[model samples]
Target: MKRRAQGALEYLFMIAAALIIIFLAVRYLTRTSSTATDLGNSTLENITQELENAGF
Candidate 1:
Protein backbone atom coordinates (compact mmCIF):
# COMPACT_ATOMS: atom_id res chain seq x y z
CA MET A 1 0.00 0.00 0.00
CA LYS A 2 2.81 2.40 0.81
CA ARG A 3 4.50 1.69 -2.52
CA ARG A 4 1.31 2.32 -4.40
CA ALA A 5 0.85 5.64 -2.67
CA GLN A 6 4.38 6.66 -3.55
CA GLY A 7 3.85 5.86 -7.20
CA ALA A 8 0.65 7.91 -7.26
CA LEU A 9 2.42 10.85 -5.70
CA GLU A 10 5.16 10.66 -8.28
CA TYR A 11 2.66 10.67 -11.12
CA LEU A 12 0.88 13.64 -9.59
CA PHE A 13 4.11 15.60 -9.43
CA MET A 14 4.97 14.75 -13.02
CA ILE A 15 1.54 15.86 -14.20
CA ALA A 16 1.86 19.15 -12.36
CA ALA A 17 5.25 19.81 -13.89
CA ALA A 18 3.97 19.02 -17.40
CA LEU A 19 1.04 21.39 -16.96
CA ILE A 20 3.35 24.20 -15.89
CA ILE A 21 5.58 23.68 -18.93
CA ILE A 22 2.63 23.61 -21.30
CA PHE A 23 1.21 26.77 -19.78
CA LEU A 24 4.49 28.61 -20.22
CA ALA A 25 4.79 27.50 -23.85
CA VAL A 26 1.29 28.70 -24.61
CA ARG A 27 1.94 32.02 -22.92
CA TYR A 28 5.07 32.59 -24.95
CA LEU A 29 3.31 31.84 -28.22
CA THR A 30 0.44 34.15 -27.36
CA ARG A 31 2.79 37.00 -26.53
CA THR A 32 4.70 36.52 -29.76
CA SER A 33 1.55 36.50 -31.83
CA SER A 34 0.34 39.70 -30.18
CA THR A 35 3.66 41.38 -30.82
CA ALA A 36 3.56 40.42 -34.47
CA THR A 37 0.05 41.78 -34.80
CA ASP A 38 1.06 45.08 -33.26
CA LEU A 39 4.03 45.38 -35.57
CA GLY A 40 1.90 44.73 -38.62
CA ASN A 41 -0.61 47.34 -37.52
CA SER A 42 2.10 49.91 -37.00
CA THR A 43 3.54 49.23 -40.42
CA LEU A 44 0.17 49.60 -42.06
CA GLU A 45 -0.41 52.92 -40.36
CA ASN A 46 2.94 54.19 -41.54
CA ILE A 47 2.16 53.25 -45.11
CA THR A 48 -1.19 54.98 -44.97
CA GLN A 49 0.41 58.16 -43.67
CA GLU A 50 2.93 58.10 -46.45
CA LEU A 51 0.24 57.60 -49.06
CA GLU A 52 -1.71 60.59 -47.73
CA ASN A 53 1.39 62.73 -47.88
CA ALA A 54 1.83 61.79 -51.55
CA GLY A 55 -1.81 62.82 -52.29
CA PHE A 56 -2.85 59.27 -53.02
Candidate 2:
Protein backbone atom coordinates (compact mmCIF):
# COMPACT_ATOMS: atom_id res chain seq x y z
CA MET A 1 0.00 0.00 0.00
CA LYS A 2 2.80 2.39 0.81
CA ARG A 3 4.55 1.52 -2.43
CA ARG A 4 1.42 2.25 -4.39
CA ALA A 5 1.10 5.62 -2.71
CA GLN A 6 4.70 6.44 -3.44
CA GLY A 7 4.26 5.59 -7.10
CA ALA A 8 1.21 7.79 -7.38
CA LEU A 9 2.97 10.68 -5.70
CA GLU A 10 5.90 10.38 -8.04
CA TYR A 11 3.63 10.37 -11.06
CA LEU A 12 1.92 13.51 -9.85
CA PHE A 13 5.23 15.26 -9.37
CA MET A 14 6.40 14.31 -12.82
CA ILE A 15 3.19 15.57 -14.38
CA ALA A 16 3.44 18.83 -12.48
CA ALA A 17 7.00 19.33 -13.58
CA ALA A 18 6.12 18.67 -17.20
CA LEU A 19 3.29 21.17 -17.08
CA ILE A 20 5.53 23.84 -15.59
CA ILE A 21 8.12 23.33 -18.30
CA ILE A 22 5.52 23.48 -21.03
CA PHE A 23 4.04 26.66 -19.61
CA LEU A 24 7.40 28.34 -19.45
CA ALA A 25 8.21 27.35 -23.01
CA VAL A 26 4.91 28.69 -24.31
CA ARG A 27 5.41 31.96 -22.46
CA TYR A 28 8.87 32.38 -23.90
CA LEU A 29 7.71 31.65 -27.42
CA THR A 30 4.85 34.14 -27.20
CA ARG A 31 7.12 36.87 -25.97
CA THR A 32 9.65 36.20 -28.69
CA SER A 33 7.01 36.21 -31.41
CA SER A 34 5.53 39.48 -30.20
CA THR A 35 8.93 41.12 -30.16
CA ALA A 36 9.65 39.92 -33.66
CA THR A 37 6.32 41.22 -34.88
CA ASP A 38 6.96 44.63 -33.39
CA LEU A 39 10.38 44.76 -34.98
CA GLY A 40 8.97 43.83 -38.38
CA ASN A 41 6.24 46.47 -38.17
CA SER A 42 8.70 49.19 -37.28
CA THR A 43 11.01 48.19 -40.12
CA LEU A 44 8.15 48.24 -42.60
CA GLU A 45 7.03 51.67 -41.49
CA ASN A 46 10.52 53.01 -41.82
CA ILE A 47 10.82 51.65 -45.32
CA THR A 48 7.48 53.13 -46.35
CA GLN A 49 8.47 56.50 -45.02
CA GLU A 50 11.75 56.37 -46.87
CA LEU A 51 10.05 55.39 -50.12
CA GLU A 52 7.52 58.23 -49.85
CA ASN A 53 10.27 60.69 -49.23
CA ALA A 54 12.03 59.44 -52.37
CA GLY A 55 8.89 60.26 -54.43
CA PHE A 56 7.51 56.74 -54.69
Candidate 3:
Protein backbone atom coordinates (compact mmCIF):
# COMPACT_ATOMS: atom_id res chain seq x y z
CA MET A 1 0.00 0.00 0.00
CA LYS A 2 0.98 3.64 -0.34
CA ARG A 3 0.97 4.08 3.42
CA ARG A 4 3.39 1.20 3.85
CA ALA A 5 5.73 2.73 1.29
CA GLN A 6 5.61 6.04 3.08
CA GLY A 7 6.44 4.39 6.37
CA ALA A 8 9.44 2.68 4.82
CA LEU A 9 10.66 5.98 3.38
CA GLU A 10 10.43 7.66 6.74
CA TYR A 11 12.41 4.91 8.39
CA LEU A 12 15.12 5.18 5.75
CA PHE A 13 15.37 8.91 6.23
CA MET A 14 15.73 8.57 9.95
CA ILE A 15 18.47 5.97 9.54
CA ALA A 16 20.36 8.20 7.13
CA ALA A 17 20.20 11.12 9.52
CA ALA A 18 21.43 8.99 12.37
CA LEU A 19 24.40 7.82 10.32
CA ILE A 20 25.35 11.40 9.44
CA ILE A 21 25.30 12.39 13.08
CA ILE A 22 27.47 9.46 14.07
CA PHE A 23 30.01 10.29 11.35
CA LEU A 24 30.23 13.91 12.51
CA ALA A 25 30.71 12.87 16.12
CA VAL A 26 33.55 10.52 15.20
CA ARG A 27 35.28 13.22 13.17
CA TYR A 28 35.01 15.72 16.00
CA LEU A 29 36.41 13.26 18.52
CA THR A 30 39.39 12.47 16.30
CA ARG A 31 40.20 16.15 15.86
CA THR A 32 39.98 16.83 19.59
CA SER A 33 42.16 13.83 20.46
CA SER A 34 44.85 14.88 18.02
CA THR A 35 44.84 18.41 19.36
CA ALA A 36 45.23 17.13 22.89
CA THR A 37 48.09 14.85 21.89
CA ASP A 38 49.90 17.69 20.13
CA LEU A 39 49.56 19.92 23.18
CA GLY A 40 50.93 17.20 25.47
CA ASN A 41 53.90 16.59 23.19
CA SER A 42 54.74 20.28 23.05
CA THR A 43 54.56 20.58 26.80
CA LEU A 44 56.85 17.59 27.25
CA GLU A 45 59.39 19.02 24.83
CA ASN A 46 59.44 22.34 26.64
CA ILE A 47 59.94 20.63 29.97
CA THR A 48 62.78 18.53 28.60
CA GLN A 49 64.51 21.58 27.20
CA GLU A 50 64.16 23.41 30.47
CA LEU A 51 65.57 20.49 32.41
CA GLU A 52 68.57 20.19 30.10
CA ASN A 53 69.23 23.90 30.40
CA ALA A 54 69.22 23.52 34.19
CA GLY A 55 72.14 21.05 33.82
CA PHE A 56 70.13 17.98 34.67
Let me know the TM-score candidate 1 reaches against the reference structure: 0.95
Looking at candidate 3, the ten consecutive residues that score lowest on lDDT are 1-10
Best by TM-score: 2
Give residue 23's lDDT in candidate 2 (0 to 100).
100
User: In model 2, what are the clashing residue pairs, if there are any?
Assistant: none
Candidate 3 lDDT over 1-56, as tens digits, reads: 99999999999999999999999999999999999999999999999999999999
* RMSD in order of candidates: 0.6, 0.4, 0.4
For each candidate in turn, the TM-score is 0.95, 0.98, 0.97
Instruction: Score candidate 2 by TM-score against the native.
Output: 0.98
Query: What tens-digit string does per-residue lDDT give for candidate 2 at 1-56?
Result: 99999999999999999999999999999999999999999999999999999999
Clashing pairs in 3: none
lDDT for each residue of candidate 1 in 1-56, tens digit (9 for 90 to 100): 99999999999999999999999999999999999999999999999999999999
